[model samples]
Target: MIGIDLGTTYSAVGVVESGFPILLANEEGRRVIPSAVWFGDGAVEVGEKALRRRGVSPVVTSVKRLMGRRPGEVDDFPLPLDEGDRVRVLGRTPEEVSAEILKELKRIAEWRLETEVRKAVITVPAYFNDAQRSATKRAGELAGLEVARIVNEPTAAALAYGLDKLGEKARVAVYDLGGGTFDLSVLEMRDGVFQVLATRGDTRLGGDDLDAALAGWCAEKAGAGAVDGRMIKEAERVKRALSADGEAVFRVPFVDGGESIEVAATRRDFEHLAAPFIERTIDCCRRAMHDAELSPADLDAVVLVGGSTRIPAVREAVSAFFDREPDLSQHPDEAIALGAAIQAGVLTGAVRKVVLLDVTPLSLGIETFGGLMNVLIPRNTTIPAKAGEMFTNAVAGQRSMSLRVLQGEREMARDNWRLGEFEVAFEPAEKGRARVGVQFRIDENGILEVLARDTATNRDTVLEIRDAAVDVDDEKVETMVSESVEHAFDDMAERVFTEARLKAEELLPAVEAVLSQGDGIVPEEEVAGIREAEATVREALDSGDANRLKAAVESLDKATEAVAARMVERAMEEALERRMGG
Candidate 1:
């Protein structure tokens, strides 16, 4: 069994051998494989190669953010393809894209071990909801591996940190800030058992946002028309340079209309641009500490995980906040994978000396009357737990009752994350006469399953909730309760139009900037076609037609597909030449 850290920016695979966990490098002898995928004409590329061709093809990066969200629920990202009610690329869902990455990792592990790899343990953010966890398991299955376990990232980090210090008792905080997710978990180690006290994080916040922050600053400094992929890459380089040096010089030649820019940015300047994001992480740390009911002084050690921790500002801030220097013994990039591998070992009986006990990050509940929340499993409860509630019809001749499952600590049902909803049918009888029992079970993987039993007949039936609709006002609830068959589609057109408008607002500037630089590079006819498509997009935007705007966006993407590919190729060549010359 291998342990896989399926991170947002990069992924790594590790294995336990001779009672110790070791990271397994990929075919290129690189331990960290960039979590990027590109859909080419005849082939699909992943890792570094896909990252290099990011702006050329339909590249999917930071897909972990989209794992559990419905296609319509997410509108911030640029996903041009659609498959029925879900987003797709080259006719592949997010799970399929993730499967490709996992498949590659599996291939590398198989090649290195010279054995058939069938089972593996994967790590995800502690705060990931049921939908996300289930989606991750599905991805692993699609990759031809049995997902032996789904471990929390911070819990895994704690395992990696506590493996060697089993004889010591300590309270440790694991700060994990990856490319697209942030999680702060507090754990206590005693004897040979590691117990997680609390975990908190934002799945959407991470280093990618830091890159965007710097890129925005760079765009403003360079007077660039927009923050494109190339600009983001350059900003990332400057960010790394500033980490080692006090200052770094940034230059971009012929950015627009034969104009070049050269600027020098100091560490202070970069920190200023990144302060908000850093502060956000610090806030999460404080909240986690509070949830764990401990002070900074109570922590025996603070362990940092993920590539973002390499930033000096981040490290300094964490040290100052925790009032002590963080333990740097474990490699930030490989610790989670190593810990996962150790957990896998425990499952396979390869490592029996250590035990891991993790907790749910949020409370699980169902909507009660008057828009109130009735929690079944409170937060921080031990995993693989089960809870059940009995319900009766509110009115006579009421055949069924709907339970809107929720996950969060909020008191109001609407404020919590809606896991899904299911209905239990009861025997026809007078008011409160029919009985039904609903069970909510969180398996070892932290995935939820709902089962309904007819108390009258003593029969059980499984219920599947596809779309987890948010809880609304009492009147809306009454309507749903009375209908018991179908829920109304409310404000769908307005939501779609708003989503389309947002996409157009983001894409227009990039299109304009690309066209601004395409005068000499792109063919005249192609440029003309792109300009026409752009006009159509503008018209759709003005007309407030979501479908029209979507069509126009697709047309524009098709028109400039070849040009974008060429531009990316040229940029790559120039970058390679610069490196070789240096």
Candidate 2:
């Protein structure tokens, strides 16, 4: 089995041999493969070939950022597709585009091993939600390889670090800042067991952002219209140069009308521009520590992962934050892939006496009454874990129940990301009579599987939570929170009205559906009262009055109280009958 790090900007493959993980070079003998794909001349190219044609062809880099995110979820990014839609990169989805990179890695592994490579363990960001994890696995399948596991990057790094220190017990923090993502994971390793405590990161913040910032600074100095891929490449080189030297000069020849632009940039200047991005990673680290319920002082050692950690400024900041020198025992680029190889070894029984216990990055739940989120599985819960809730209908003769599965840390269902909605069909029992057990299981790969079992029939139905539209506005959370506080007075009335209108909209359909189900069961006078309340609500909705709509909704609720109770009673009776019959 081969281990692959399907990274955002670059990827690497490795395998275990003789109880040690060994990195495999590509056909060019290069250890790293640029995560780029190019389509031109009726041919597809990956890695360096695709990267070289970036400015000319329709080359797609950082396609990993688009993984698991819907079309409209990403904004301000230069993409070939429109918002809320998918664009075919040579008739391939983003997953398929990623699969091309995986296929390249598979080929490399096969060539080196002199055997077929069919199974592998892949690593993703620790904070990747359910959708991203699923998409990553799908990409592997499309590449004609069975993904044995979806390991977390930082967790994998921890594995690599702790592999030799199996007998030692320690609390370690893994700070991973890669090309297009940043993750901070806190783990406790003891007796060869690596247990992750907490993980947090910004999928959109990474070395790519810093490169863009430096490129923009260089472009402004050069008086160019915009920074192109070539200029950005130069900016990256200058960034690396400044890490060792006090200053570096970035020169672009013939940028405009046979004129060259040169700018001498100092380390201080690069640090100044990179300060905000670096601070963001630090903030994520602090949050992860907080969630893990430990301070920096509590950490035994802080291990740095990702090539971005090579920057001197990043190391200084990390040192300052943790009050100690960051451990650089492992190579930033190869640690994760190496750890993945170790995992593959364990899975194949080639390596012995090691185990990894990962955790879900976000909370999983369903919407309850009043739009509140009822969490079934809290964030950071150990993987290969299961949590279940028993649900029943509110009225008699209800055939099915619909539940919207969500993933996020938000308190409200609407604020969190909707994984998907599923329906559990029952055998036409009274409300509250059918016994349906809904279980959510997160496997070792951090992917979620929901199952609904009918207790009476002893039948189970597996639900496929497909096409999850995750809200991945990584940079907007703080801005939105601050704006909500500062402008709360200004938008209070509009916000109230909007919320009330939404309630009215929700109540209208629910009222109609309940009435349709209990038409003959409900008293005629009570039905008339419910109809009047519904009409009042409609009028209030049209009048654009928040108070009126709220009052109307309350009235409708009061009018249908007896009917709702009777529906529940009928359901309970049906349930009793079914149990007795069985």
Candidate 3:
């Protein structure tokens, strides 16, 4: 059995031998495989060697970006090259690209183990939405591997660390700060059952952003007017260097025959520059802990995964947040792959008693009148959660009624993204007479499936939401996929803008309420700044610019910390006073 850590920056393949998971090294003796693929001369090449051909070949990284996109949903995906880069986006789905990577892993596993590897377990972000999860499964199918199960990255890390501590129950928080994403999950383990209580993180936030920020800082220090790709790559190198050492000096290579410049960063300075990113993840951890109803002291242990977690600052922040020195014996980069192998054993009945219970990451709701979204399943809700609602015809002799499904926590359906639509036919009857029972079920896999039953006739209809937004045909999918590649960076920027705006809107009213109540000891100038930030956010929203919304909200977030802290304290005090009958 094989386990694969299908990561954003790099991938690792491993197998269980005598109960120990061992990573398989490639011919170059590197255990970590670059998650890069280049198409050249009708051949698909993956990993480090192929990555060298990136500029001329069509290369894709973070294909995971396409995980949950609906059919026909158009967005630029990262091809990481120019349109004339000789790599035409033709007939290859993200699923296929991912499959090629998995296939390479499988081939490596087979070659190393001296046997045909067929079954495997794969790790995914615990917070991966439905589309990404399904795309992973499809990638496995395309690779011709029996995907034993899709295990959460944090869960796998916990298992890799906890297998030695069986029979003892522990509350574990897995802090996974990876190359491209961050996920903090709280789990309870007892009697061979690993139950996830709550999980939170941003799929877009990670080390990449930190590197980009540092790169910009370096560019400014170099007296450059604009930061370019080479500067960004140099900054990333400095970041990686500072991870293990106390200080790192970057000697930037000049691009236009100009003299090279050196930029130095101490670990402390790096942490300061990366403070906002670390703090953002810490906030997410707080939310997850709150959702699980567990405090920092309640966590028996903290486990870290991802290359980013190797940073001393990240470890310190996590330790401070959870109030525990996390177990660092497991290699952050390889832990997930090891845990995946363990899961494979469980699925293959090699380790016959442990079971994992995952949960949905976001709220799934239906669009009501006035575009209000009624949530069916809220975020952090236990997996396999089921809910039912009764529907009836509003007009006389109505034959069909439609159910518009959405996912997100926004109050308005228009604000939330639509997942799909389901329509059920019923026997014609008087207005508001025909009753149809609609059941929305989310499986352990977190995919939504709908079932509608006609109470009048005992007839039933079941529908699985299709990717009507995805171009499935080889040619069309290929063309769109290529187009997306060309526009990938732009698309990501736009998405970030959109998410930021939504977050700002979520915080605005609360900030205003606090100001009205004089809840905190915030200075007048700070309060004014918060208001200013709110206005900027609202303006971005009104303009319908997702990117602007994101930027404005981020600006507001930076300016309103004092206000937020005070508001939270006031809320806590009121709750405490009410609880004590004061």
Rank the candidate models, highest lDDT first. Answer: 2, 1, 3
The 10 consecutive residues of candidate 3 with the worst lDDT sum are 469-478
Q: Against the true structure, whose lDDT is highest?
A: 2
Best TM-score goes to which candidate?
A: 2
Model 1 per-residue lDDT tens digits across residues 1-582: 999999988999999999889989977889989888887777888899898886566678788877766655555554455747765656778889999899989998999999999999999998776767878998999999999999999999899989988999999999998888888999999988898888878777788888888877877877778766666667778888988999998776677556766778899998998788888789778877877999999999999998888899999999999999998887889999999999999999988878888888777888765566678998888888899998777668988778888865555566566767667766789977888788889888888888878899887877564532332321122122223222223233434555666566767787788878745767887878888988998899889775777788888878878987888998999999999999
Q: Per-residue alpha-carbon lDDT of model 3 for 1-582, expressed as tens digits? A: 788999877898987777666889888898889887877777888998776875455567666655555433323334432233122234467678788899999999988989998888888887676667777888898999988778788888888887776688999999999877788889998988888998877766677778878877877777865665456557778998998899898777664568786878788888889999898889778878878998889988888889998888999998888777987888988999988888877766666567788887667777653345677788778877899887678668889878787776555566456667777788899967999887779876666787778898888888766543122321232123234346667655555554565466567876677678763467777877888888888898788776678778889888877666776787899899999996
lDDT of 1: 0.81
Residues 1-582 of candidate 2 have per-residue lDDT tens digits of 999999998999999899998889987898888999887667778999988886666678888887877666665454456433563444567898899999999999999999999999999998776778888999999999999999999998998899899999999999999989998999999998899999878788888888889989988977787777767778888988988899999887777556777988999999999999999889878878878999999999999999899999999999999999999998988899989998999999887888999988677888764465678999789988999999777568888778888876555567666777877777888757888888999899988898888888888888786654455564543333334346555454444556677667767887788778755778777878889999998998788776777788889878878877888998999999999999
What value does the lDDT take at residue 455 in candidate 1? 96
TM-score of each: 0.78, 0.81, 0.74
- Report how far off residue 177 is in candidate 1 (Å): 0.8
Judge candidate 1 at residue 574 and give its lDDT.
95
Stretches of candidate 1 above 4 Å error? 78-84, 256-258, 465-582
Provide the clashing-pair count of each candidate structure: 0, 8, 16
